[model samples]
Target: MPLNIDWRQILLHLFNFCILAIALYFLLYKPVKNFMAKRSARYEEEAAESAKLKAEAEELKKQYSDKLTNADAEIEAKRSEALHELHDYREKLVSEAEQEAGEIVEKAKKDASRERKKIIDGAGKEIADMVGAAAEKVVLGSTADAYDAFLNAAEKSIEKEENEIK
Candidate 1:
């Protein structure tokens, strides 16, 4: 009252401000704080779950990569093995062909040799018959000498035929 100050009005206004503060704390501040806490907890849980999923994905990726590499190596090994087998088979076929060729050549040589011997024997017999006929016509008086001469001539003819054929 001394300086126109109304102490009663001041006290009443202060009391009203206290009531408003308390009401706001309970109605707005507490609810907002609890909502924020729940939201933060949910966000943290989602982050943990996301991290776990990411880690599992990374593990699966690494495993798949390893398997892919191993598969490539396995495929290469199989291809190499197949190629080696093919090469071996080729060699075996070549060897068999060579052996067959050698056998064919040997058979041909044997056939030719037998044919040559047959021809030589036939020629020798023909020459002997011809010489015997000539001797009989030329020397009717000296039979022994004629026979010896025919034998010598036939032997010489056979030797000459063999040498020429060779």
Candidate 2:
């Protein structure tokens, strides 16, 4: 046999290698590649769904935050309104109390004045009666003209005092 390569043998080996490569591609490589592609697609779809759910969660969180802020503002407003109402109520009560106190004082003053006038009139009548009795006894021995003169002076003095009081 010659050491030189045979063309026919070389051609046969090249043809057999082509057939084996084709067979491996169709039997193993194609199916593995297709499965890998399907797995990648599934992963990408899951990632997209996760992102969408995350965005939805963020929106919900923002909505709840806004609601909480609004509730706080409303509570503050209501508290302020209540405080204003309380202040007004306190002022009204104080005003009414002062007015009632003033009225009571005025009534007391009027009552006191009436009582004083009654006491003064009673004292004056008693004094006049006592003086008349004394004058009658003292003037019993006097002449009728002298007695009448004394009585007239006493009546004039009483009238003058009464006029001053009035």
Give the Å error, residue 10, model 1.
1.9
Q: Which segments of model 1 are wrong by more than 4 Å? A: 2-4, 140-166
| Number of colliding residue pairs in model 1 | 0
User: If scored against the real structure, what TM-score would every candidate get?
Assistant: 0.75, 0.73
Using TM-score as the measure, the top candidate is 1
In model 1, the worst 10-residue window by lDDT is 137-146
Evaluate all candidate structures by whole-model CA lDDT and list the values in order: 0.88, 0.84
lDDT of candidate 2 over 121-154, digit per residue (tens): 8657755665675577566655565566656766
Model 2 spans > 4 angstroms off: 130-166
Provide the lDDT at 121 for model 1.
86
RMSD, each candidate, Å? 5.5, 7.3
